[model samples]
Target: MTRPQLTYRSWATALAALVTAAATALIGPAAPAQAAAVTFTNPLAEQRADPHVYRHTDGYYYLTATVPEYDRIVLRRATTLQGLATATERVIWRRHGSGEMGAHIWAPEIHFIDGRWYVYFAAGRTEDIWAIRPYVLESSAANPLDGPWVERGQLQPARSSFSLDATTFVHNGVRYLAWAEYAGSNSNIYLARAVNPWTYTGTPALIATPTYAWETRGYRVNEGPAVLIRNGRVFMTYSASATDASYAVGLLTAAAGSDLLNPASWSKRATPVLASDGRTGQWGPGHNSFTVAEDGSDVIVYHSRNYERYLGNGYDPLSDPNRRTRIQRVYWNADGTPNFGVPVPDGLTPVRLRSHDLPDRYLRHWEFRARLEPNVTNLADSQFRIVAGLSNASAISLESTNYPGYYLRHRNHQVWVERSDGSALFRQDATFTRRAGLADATKVSLESVNFPGQYVRHRDGLLYLEAVPDAAGRASATFALD
Candidate 1:
């Protein structure tokens, strides 16, 4: 007997009732079904949108998105999928002011190319951050952390009034660039070949358009185009409808060996591969990208607004709607097509894959509090190594020993003990767990690495503070109720 086919729209409502009934229909399961599924919407990071995730060859998954912070690009990488929230982050690069790069940058993508790394992003000039043109940044380092990112300058733009979400793909030894252009005669998902980064000799070909009823929800607009090639097929996934309730994802496909430029080559999938539903409790699940788990399981990463609708007056809960990041596992059908699972709710601990092992080598696994040795210090700009306020020459270096748990600090908010262990204490789901209160640490017993900053869990919220030891030469901490 053959299993029946299901459309993406009905798939979630169906799966949640059957395959995921334990996680969906029943909560705080009487039987606590196994804990694996995509991450529930992160309440802490929910105020964001346009989340992009990529797995680097270095055994780390790097994720970034539009955030309230405009000073620098925030990024984090972790060995495990769940550690992303508390992972170490570095402002790899930043724009000085509000000109071409001075204001409102969106949808930055970091791609590894030709033994080096390059980041492609959309930013508008200071006058209008939304004039939004695609730009590229290059870093020659083996890893992006040891920064010194070199601005490669604006990549070849679409020459239209607005274009963004630039992504590069190599096919048949030829490199191609795909993007969304709204300033042209018409707005659609377009592709062009670049013998190099800045030149495109042929005219752009339109692969997909917003004609389907689902695709034309609020506006006949489609943007944020990303392409994935699998099994001799080119799959172009693009965001359709407006950025609000109308937001959804549409798929375009073409024969692997067909002339990509041929207008008829690419066919719309007829329906959205993903969409939003108030019924499932996850609102606006669109603008997505894909990643592979440590053992190569397909993980879908996307941005979403929580049960919010309408951008109206007075403190809109969805006001900060770049959308927070969410992840879910996806499997291909028997024919090698994509199958996106339903969105997991907030606060639910995801089930770990049966094959995952505890990576405890660094003792980084448990989240802890920390304490810095009393010495000269310059906490800012210098990271963990601090210079004495009285003397610049004398600096103290310390590791982030705090286990990823809760840390109590003096009211001044500076200098306190944190976890020294490498592991994080709280679970990764975005739900703020208020189940058990934190157990205060002994006045002098601190276990985390000290100094620069320590990550502590509070009601499930991760925060950082200055480390201060008691005058009695003792460090203090709080044990996680986690």
Candidate 2:
């Protein structure tokens, strides 16, 4: 089904209903839903926007963002996602005092290319703050956080106009650059072939124009283009509308081998793929980047304002200081399009449990029935918040994402989704303890709390509580979290 478009006029009324839905919709079942004790929570850093995070091959997660001050560029490195909250930051570069790049620094992205590190950022001059342009910085130091940065000059497009949020990626052996540009009275996304580290080889192609109602909500915009290439497709996501509660994300897709330079080769989705969810306290979420987690799962890093209203008295929504840097898992649909489930709420983290025997299928309930189906697509439905159960803190309850109040429960040796009744039988029946998998140490087996020795197993394409009597039973009982 197509998602509904968000409009600025209905912000107040929509937010009210969203808050109610969030209060009851737990991302997972009630209990120890947190995957680990040391895991991180959302709103990763306050007053940080246009966030870019990358997991470096050197074994560290490096992050850079536009500071609230907008006067200098800063960098942070952490060994883990949660550790970034307290990781020390260093001022890498400062805005020029009185000329080009003198003020309004915004949307800085760090990339490691050709054995050296570079930072692509947007800035405006002190005299003309709206004449924003893209610039590049080079760091010869092996560690981007270790030394001095050299100015590599501005990245001028074929046409000298207002441009920002420039990102570069290589596809099919060619390098390409994408950014947002001022087109007529609105902003639209444009693409160019990169000649080298700093300039476009030819004229920038007008790739996407904001024509839909969602893209033209408060303002006609299609900025902050972020690219993800997967499943034989090149998916580019851009932020639309105004940077307020009305702000959202729109998607453009093209075949992996298509001519990216041709504007007609790409197609835009009719609706905003990601937008503000008042229930989750994430408003105007956009300007996103992609990364990989420690377990090699796809992760999305973006900035969002927690509150809906504009704090500034002026008409400029860009002055809003509530945009906080955040991160979450990115899932894919069966048709290969990305399914970014709602930006998870602030507290406990969510996880996906994949069957050990059927590696392609993650455990998901269909109409309160548990079964092993291949290529399970919808992320929200497949994800079960695993929290410590009510009966025992160590035991966990599996909550369904689509059916918020329902949990995975076993009855008469069969596993199924049932509503939580807050009873002894319900608590005992819903809770499960993680045990070592019979097949290997890397996988795990879930044992029912009430049914002692019996483990939750997948047999003959169905789930049931049973004893592992043979190799097939052991394999069927094991699972992995991705």
lDDT of 1: 0.53
Would you list the C-alpha lDDT of every candidate in the order shown? 0.53, 0.78
Best by lDDT: 2
User: Ten-residue segment with the worst summed lDDT in candidate 2?
Assistant: 29-38
Residue-level lDDT of model 2, residues 1-482, one tens digit each, is: 12342243145234433532342232222323222222235666667899998778888888999987788899999987756666778989999989899988999999887878989999888999888888999998977888689998789543378889989888998888888989788898989888887888877888999999878877888999999999999999999888887788889999998999999999999988777776556778889998877655677888887778642456566766668888888877778889887766654456667788788877777777787777665566676666667577656777665566678889888889888898899888888887766676566688888778889988777789999889888888987765
The list of candidate 2 runs beyond 4 A from truth reads 1-40, 157-159, 278-281, 307-317, 401-406, 411-425, 458-474
Relative to the true structure, candidate 2 reaches a TM of 0.83
Write the residue-wise lDDT of candidate 1 on 353-388 in tens digits.
Answer: 111111111111122332222111211101121111
RMSD of 2: 8.2
| Among all candidates shown, the one with the greatest TM-score | 2
Which residue runs of candidate 1 sit more than 4 Å off their true CA positions?
A: 1-45, 69-71, 184-186, 197-199, 311-322, 348-482
TM-scores of all candidate predictions against the true structure: 0.61, 0.83
lDDT score of model 2? 0.78
